[model samples]
Target: MTLFDSERPYKYIMDTSSILSQKPGETHTRLVYKSQWERIEEYMRSHSIVTCSEIFEEIKDKEIKEWIFSQQCTVLEIDDDIQNNVRKIVTENPKMIEFTGKSGTSSGDAFLIATAMKYGLIIITEENKDKQMKIPQISKKYGITSVNITSLCEMEQWKF
Candidate 1:
């Protein structure tokens, strides 16, 4: 089912890097950083969410994985449909696809983009890189919106 099929319709796709940045008890400023996963948990309860297996692997910390599992987030698998779609994206965007060779196409970033495109969902990331190698570029190319974690928190009025 598509993301929009849900009653609330999940508006963001969580990436592994974003998840990592949200670890509880992690220090940022003088205070311990609050878990963004908590925000995600609430979102999932009201809307549809999607993530990749690669993201799960990236969160190797047992604590984080267990938290993710407890949240019951949907784990997207690499099936023929996603594979074919990735192939098409690579073929269509040759310049961007080249970066996949060095950094690898099986990256969680690539999977996030492909899944967002397939399910028509927006991407939420913490990266500020403006280069074409970034997921924001791919999201722009596919007409999908992406925002940083801070912006997302602001949008939801979630204060840390």
Candidate 2:
């Protein structure tokens, strides 16, 4: 079953995995290599797509980072409400947060989910739903809809 409703003008909160995914065949990476960035740019400009600020820290590609910044998408700040929601998620599922081999744990996944919870938006993530301790699974557990990049293209009927 599809994660999203058959509604017009869908809005989404993107996870870092979705943004940086490089799935083989008809994926964003291939699209970008084919000089189809304009299509994606147009789509992003037209859609109500946003992401958490932590995506910046999670994304390792400098070019993609610059591209995202240039797209002018709404970068949701981790305010008190989002922080509280993240805490709740972490408390309930301690395994959701991963250690980044740094001083603190990686909060991108939690923050992305929390942002979606706060805004009541669907989550766009490349994480497999079958995998444990992943965004899709955790999102499903929390009653949130999560779809992959390919699903997003299909749902939106992007003719590319």
Candidate 3:
């Protein structure tokens, strides 16, 4: 069975950055405002889409991790297929050169995008750069739609 077979076909994919925003932390403060948290909860509960464990590690907030587990969010498993796809993206995407610079995009981000593409999922991220420097750009290149937390809330009609 597909992940969203019972519900609407899963259209939304969340990056660690987007999911991690709901958790309290220094970066979390800047990631998303307090008003968005409620909507995030509502959306997750209603939609059944969520970030993977790699995303959890990037979050760096214990409370958020606990909350994620408590919510029973589906944890994506990284297998050979996902790893191969990530490698393919890294090798093929020229923009990745400029985007990551010396450090390069993390394996987690690549895996997230690859998994989304493989499953035909829409990515949700906060990075606003127009180019393919972030997941949004990569998603765009792969023809996967992407949006921010606030936009998602609006789409879902999630009210505080």
Candidate 4:
């Protein structure tokens, strides 16, 4: 089954980095910050936005982690196809994921890309385009579209 509505103009899958971009500050968290977070949360709740379930492991901030869980967004599970694609991506580009000094768990970069490939979804990420290992670059190699949150908003003509 498709994760997106066939009638919708655009369908997007978010990477952990892009999701965390809306996170509030540690000190002096203002109302506007909370409002922005809530707005994104509301959008996710109503939209066909999806994200890899593995992102839960990558999230370290308690508030951001909680926000992710609280949202009603669809969390894509890792299937054999996604796993195999992830293997191919990781084997070909080791720098795409940083596993050094960490446990068995790694970043959700590969999973995000694989999911986007599997479902024909455009990736929403915060990684810069200048970086070779970033999602935008790696996704391009696989013929997948990747855009930042700001671009997504502009494309959708969202005011907030």
Maximum-lDDT candidate: 4
| Order of candidate numbers by lDDT, starting with the best | 4, 2, 3, 1
* Comparing 3 and 4 on lDDT, the stronger one: 4
Distance from true location, Cα of 96 in model 2, Å: 1.1
Instruction: Give lDDT tens digits, candidate 3, residues 1-160.
Output: 3656445545666887677555456344634566666555555666557665566666666786787777666667777777887888888875554544454355567778877766677778877748556878777877878888777777777676
- Tens-place lDDT per residue, model 4, 44-122, is 7765677778875677889777776788777778999999999999999987777687543356888888888887889
Which 10-residue window of candidate 4 scores lowest in summed lDDT?
Answer: 23-32
The weakest ten consecutive residues by lDDT in model 1 span 25-34
lDDT of 1 at 95: 58
- 88, model 2: CA deviation in Å? 0.6
Between the candidate structures 1 and 3, which one is better when assessed by lDDT?
3
Error of 2 at 102 (Å): 10
Candidate 2 yields a Cα-based lDDT of 0.74
| Runs with alpha carbons beyond 4 Å of true place in candidate 1 | 1-8, 24-31, 35-37, 93-106
Off by over 4 Å in 3: 1-9, 23-36, 94-105
The better candidate by lDDT, 1 or 2, is 2
